[model samples]
Target: MRRRPSKEQFEQQIEQTAKALHDEMIAGKWAAGSFLPPEKSLEARFGLSNYSIRLGLEQLVQEGWIEKIAGVGNRVVATRPQVKLTIACENVTLRNLKTSGAGRTISAFYPWIQVEFLSMISPIPGTDLSERTLAGDLVLLDNVQFQQLSENRLTHLLEPLSEDDEWYPQFTKHFSVEGRRLLQPIVLSPLVLCYNKAHFRESGLAEPNGSWTWNDLIRHAELLYDGRGRYGFAFHIQSLYRWPLFLIQSRERFEESGEEFLRSRSSRLLDGLKLCKDILHNRKAVPLYLSENNDDINRMFMEGKLSMTLNTYMGLNSWNEAEIEYDISPVPYMDSPRTLLITLGAGINGSSEHKEEARLLVDFLGRCGRERESAYADRIRHYCKCCAQRLP
Candidate 1:
């Protein structure tokens, strides 16, 4: 008997199938106005079920890569001159077609950009998309990717989008190179302390505050521990986003690998490393981080398994429906309140022939983050496309 695949496995198969078909289309395997391979042929090619093949094709149709002809088949949309804009996206979560809000946040921006233009949005696989590659006319990028593309000269230096008086000047400067701001910021969040207030009330502990120090966090965390199945403090300490918190706090760059990093002479850097080390080794404070992704850590926070953890606004996207009581505060400071910020923005591909169209998309997406701002999520509601998922 054939064994059934897990949900994750099935989703991976769908993404692989979608990416396989997308890569082929972009590489010009199938000519314009031609119908894609039949479902049976695609099934054999990608080793997916008929349903999975249909779902994969459905994603392409939604992205405008193909159109379904009644009673015929899905035909590849004609390329270029007819369509003024082409969008390239990163599969930050490998989910562009899901019905849920979290899955569709990034995907929903395409329709607004597609207004009055024949456009296709391809969520290029992160592994397949390189630092210097331009998959489409306009690319949706995060802070890091935009900077990388800017450094490599692959992104169009959008002259008109340089300044918005309301935007954080420093962040706007981060996207600029040699007097030209390249990408427009859409959504951003700084690392903050997220705690289960119920846990604090139950534990008779005062809530966290900006004035708290690392030593205070460690002490409160110890008190917060109930010797129950839950851990008082924990995070996916190995995450790139999490691990760097220590170095950034120390105001030092521990940029090295192997023996060189291990033998670094920077005392301030070592001080930060020691903090992370203590927390990881202090089993009474944090649990063993054996699980994958921030979701594993986030699940603990959501289910009341963790009392407190460091998080960004994006991590709380699902908290809208959680029954648990929680609150946010500035992360405990070591030396100062300086914290890491993560931003998602859009950039125009330098090679894009349709510069004006690309600008419109960025303008619409980055237009305003503060209009309906909430105490919890600053500008998240508008750009996250969580107009469907309301935040408290």
Candidate 2:
């Protein structure tokens, strides 16, 4: 006399039920030798039908949360999951980042979703035409790295997310290809001015705020420079992440490349480029030594080698526990007020056999990422399929 449970309803009940029981078990929830509460009690407690309760219990068994005894009930078999989840990644983003706040959260929470989270990441992949990108159950890439995989390749490699628009509308849709979603965002950060507060206090210069401009920053840099070991401000001018912000804020679609482009809104582009060049060559503004990459900038900033540098939230993980007193502010803009926002996201491999589990990871990260940073992850991906970005 019970009605049928819809597939959607059944799946939701199962996922939620498993997560709840998993939490309880993790908290030393069960009594009588870690035996799960009676199925009838679980059914009533979770508002799930008897069939739904059994299905939820079955998932836990499959996930190695418990073992089913003959004729009695399900009992704890492994305190930790015996499953190993493989995810294709880049070593720099995850392995070196475990010490950061966001990175630490990810490292800690990865076990919450699954105990044996195995990662085999390639440091840098070549762009050989014949070379194929080998993958596992999941792959994570930022917007810039996503370009390494061609549009057709990305389309073939990723599947549409089960839950569309689970994060911010802009980020949610950023992973779509040809109106079909291909990934979900997990973490994001906007470019901000990371500065040493002590330096500003020592020099009697007011800390930078939202109203700072290029000229203001340059003038302050001249003052902050000690002419001994430290400089005022420094960032890698050659970084793909740093250089592009100049052209983007210049505010032109930039289809034409000749004088026509320069005559258009591209004049701002020239100004932006000039500023970058001046900053790089400005002896009074930057350090004598060159910065190789963003990591170098972060390290020097933490060591008090420089007063300020442009960085993203993800980049802040390096200094999450640094003993220095540092704060972040809006990056000084040129003619237009804009900042480069970056996001790192996860996608299920199109051909992965364990796609359902991958979806669970995507969903779990999507839900959890919102808790960590509600608004900054994966803000740019599919929006500019051809790399022609429109202001967000």
Candidate 3:
């Protein structure tokens, strides 16, 4: 019979549970006003009593991390503060000035210089102190991202995509974007494919190279299968979105021309679905179902039972914390090496009272110098670049 966890073990489990919930919030898995799993279900999943689960939920609620409705259950309340902005402006150049010319008396000779100064500083307002601009209501205008400057209103919301027929016409009309500044663009990191080095060696298979393709993956999975209890590969169904990385690797475009320009070709989508079904059914190389209810894959990986799994870089961090021996490779490709990327950004609400401050925060993100930009980049770098192919 299996042994029950000791008191110390139980405490550790509670900590792990709390950390998982926190990670989910960071990933935007739980949106605003969405309730998490019920306490009873959580208790079963964590192998704890109702009281222990309640304690964890209560801690989240007290920290303003989440809010508990009278009958609706606990919902994520706290989101990351948008004091910093992340922007993409690869072509624009900015100028730096040590002192302003407001106090100095200037003659007509300064005409050209005055025009240059005004041209540089006119588009961006925060740099000029003499101008009668609203300082608190800072407004940052990037290509597609924005943020608020106020401390109380720090939620990062994404701006609706533009509907310009030139690019995405439907989106342009949806957002009513006839005349609006595009926020700065933010790049997302690619999902990573991870495996256990020790397991590979023990099974007499070579460590997968970064250039391995989908067929290579299938062959490796076949070698690793024991056909007794554990499977060769297992991933959560919800994470199937990453399958597009394989299609990209194969050099297939996700979109094609059609009356409904946004609609995907059924044949291409079927091919992708078949690939997953083959891995899970035809070859029986992976399990068809693996509940993330309690992070079952994570448990299996930590226990040294799983040979391979595909997940985000953040998932790798969890494996490291659990002391699991593993290595990460690029997601397998079909023709070219590519991985799906998921980017995030912040925006000010249209109805926000602190519009100017929000704009300042957004401006700071895009136009700010290297120091601030690097800080933001470093925060999420670990999860952003595992085996990712550069966009050409």
Candidate 4:
């Protein structure tokens, strides 16, 4: 015995089908001014009868999303869905973005799409990241948090990057979780050794090279130590950004549990910490008051009180502004050349109603290569690095 849907049930099914198609149209599945598939194809696609398909199309026609002709198929009337993409970010990050001209750039890129930037404050204090993304169309997360979003299924797994999508492999790997790419990297900030040229020249020490090891760096740092207010090496003592480089350089993965990592190379970790302490306290190679504040370190470096420090590309902005004579080099390593990469990226919220618009905004922010310079993306292209392969 088989049961067929009643008239009311059939009509409900048609309404549901209509809503699905309408959402698809709103999602930019098909271009506007183009005809929808034939009724037979629609029947197969939605697993509904031909009458249901017609009813669904008629429903959409009433919604102004499509129009049916006498003999032809249903024509799409609206291509771009009217959606305001809401980007959630921290206050400082938002300020930096505004200062960097992100808003004007995105507006020029997608004139039809509306964008809204929201300061992401927890509903309650310390609600954490998962709760934050649930309310946003797009979210800005650092590399570690971005991976958490993908691992926890909080982000929409984006489509595969095309051949033309330009990104550095080194940076891209930091954002990839499992098998899918969920985050669109917007900034490139990597940990590096920032050296003061004057310090090296005064000490008669040659500039650091890739071949330099941790021992060589320590030696050079000791040589440059003037035993006065000046220091050979200095870095934020309690900084996550700088400490992780020690673990990475030692060919160890970061473990939330210190027990596991310590069992193998407890001495190495101890040695690393001891080295920093000796430089700061015993050797007096670093200013004693120097702690975990980057701004203070940046100020000290700018004042020519420190020789070398571990920093990122962002540090350059301050140094460049101060016109400090500094050059960057790869961080010295113990076993392997490793540097901690810090990046900020955007990912679409899985349950967002404005996925298409959110995607467009993220893509615009992350776009690279030559074509982007010619498109609306050109407005923000100043933030990106241009090369001979791409046109200005």
- Tell me which of candidates 3 and 4 scores higher on TM-score: 4
Q: Which has the better TM-score: candidate 1, or candidate 4?
A: 4
Candidate 2 structure lDDT? 0.68
Q: Which window of ten consecutive residues has the lowest lDDT sum in model 4?
A: 383-392
Best by lDDT: 2
- Give one clash count per candidate, in the order shown: 0, 3, 32, 0
Give per-residue CA lDDT, model 3, range 211-279, as digits (tens): 777678878887787777556777765443345554544444545467433454454545665676677
Which run of 10 residues does model 1 get worst, by summed lDDT?
383-392
Q: List TM-score per model, in order.
A: 0.61, 0.71, 0.46, 0.65
Report the candidate with higher TM-score, 2 versus 4: 2
Better of 2 and 3 by TM-score: 2
User: After superposing candidate 4, which stretches have Cα over 4 Å from the reference?
Assistant: 1-29, 32-51, 54-81, 91-100, 122-135, 146-189, 197-205, 222-230, 253-266, 282-284, 302-304, 313-322, 343-345, 359-392
* Cα RMSD (angstroms) for every candidate in the order listed: 17.5, 7.4, 27.3, 7.9
lDDT of 4 by residue, 2-114 (tens): 57999898989998998777656654576688888899998898888787788888888876778877899888884444557778775545644552467667666555567
Worst 10 residues of 3 by lDDT: 90-99
Q: Provide the lDDT at 115 for model 4.
A: 74
C-alpha RMSD of candidate 4: 7.9
lDDT of 1 by residue, 1-392 (tens): 99999999998899888877775665457766899988889888887889999998898888778888888898988742233465555544212211144224433443323322112233322222453345566666656556555556654443435466666575577677777777777666567788999989988889998788888888888888878778888888756556667777777655567776776665687888898898778778888767676778888888888999987765566566789889987777678765666666667766677665566566656764433233436434322221211110
- State which candidate has the highest TM-score: 2
